[model samples]
Target: MIALTCLCGQVRTELGKRPDFIHACNCTLCSKSGAHWGYFHPSEVCVEGDTKGYCRSDKEAPSAEIHFCEQCGSTTHFTLTADAVAKFGNVMMGVNMLLADERDLAGVEVRFPDGRAWPGAGEFTYVREARFIGEG
Candidate 1:
């Protein structure tokens, strides 16, 4: 199990197990927020504390809602929006791997998928190749 906590200690999430992998998507929101993502189902994780969520204001129907710490403003996790849930049924949740110790992430692969040009419903074009968390 792994635990992720925000800088202010106001929000915390416990992942039941190690994530399969993490993504570093190069998109407007992700790029600006500086998030390294580890995806899982909500059942695989437990969250505590209050977080404010933000969906893309630029899109008519944003797919996911980004969550952050209410106190220190640290990006924590994301859940699918209601519109997205209706289609996808809350199948995915994303945690900010940047909150964990690098050593804890050890051999997990970090993928650089190009979300900027992603079609939003299919596989993404990888702008950069994948790398393990600890590679020299």
Candidate 2:
């Protein structure tokens, strides 16, 4: 299992398994938060502690519920809404890798996705690809 906590340790998250993928996105929200997302099913993660939520809306997609530590304001992870789950078949959780312990990142590949032009974008322009800190 992989464990993560907010800057103030007010919020925590746990992943039952290694992530499917880890990637940095250039979308507006991602850019602002400076997060490298580690994607997984919501069922594979557990969130604890007091978290404040912010729902971000997009014209082309469902609003996502972003949760952050209420105390230190550090982002923990985000969940896709029920409306999005219906379309996607499951809820996708994007956990912030920055909060993870370096040892938990073993064998994880970090990819870059060009989300700045998302829906209308032709193809992603990957800037870098590498195994994360603890990856062998």
Which candidate achieves the best lDDT against the true structure? 1
Per-residue lDDT for 6-78 in model 1, tens only? Answer: 9988999898888899999998989877788999999998999999999989999988899999999999999
Q: Give the Å error, residue 35, model 2.
A: 1.6
- Name model 2 segments beyond 4 Å from true: 57-63, 120-123, 130-136
Q: Count the clashes in each prediction.
A: 0, 1
Model 1, runs deviating above 4 Å: none
- Model 2, span 1-136: residue lDDT tens: 8889999887888889877668788788887876788888778999999988777655556556788888988988888877777877675789998898867776677877777766653777765565565545
Instruction: Give the Cα lDDT of each candidate.
Output: 0.91, 0.79
Which has the greatest TM-score?
1
Could you tell me the TM-score of candidate 2? Answer: 0.84
Q: What 10-residue stretch in candidate 2 is worst by lDDT? A: 127-136
lDDT of 2: 0.79
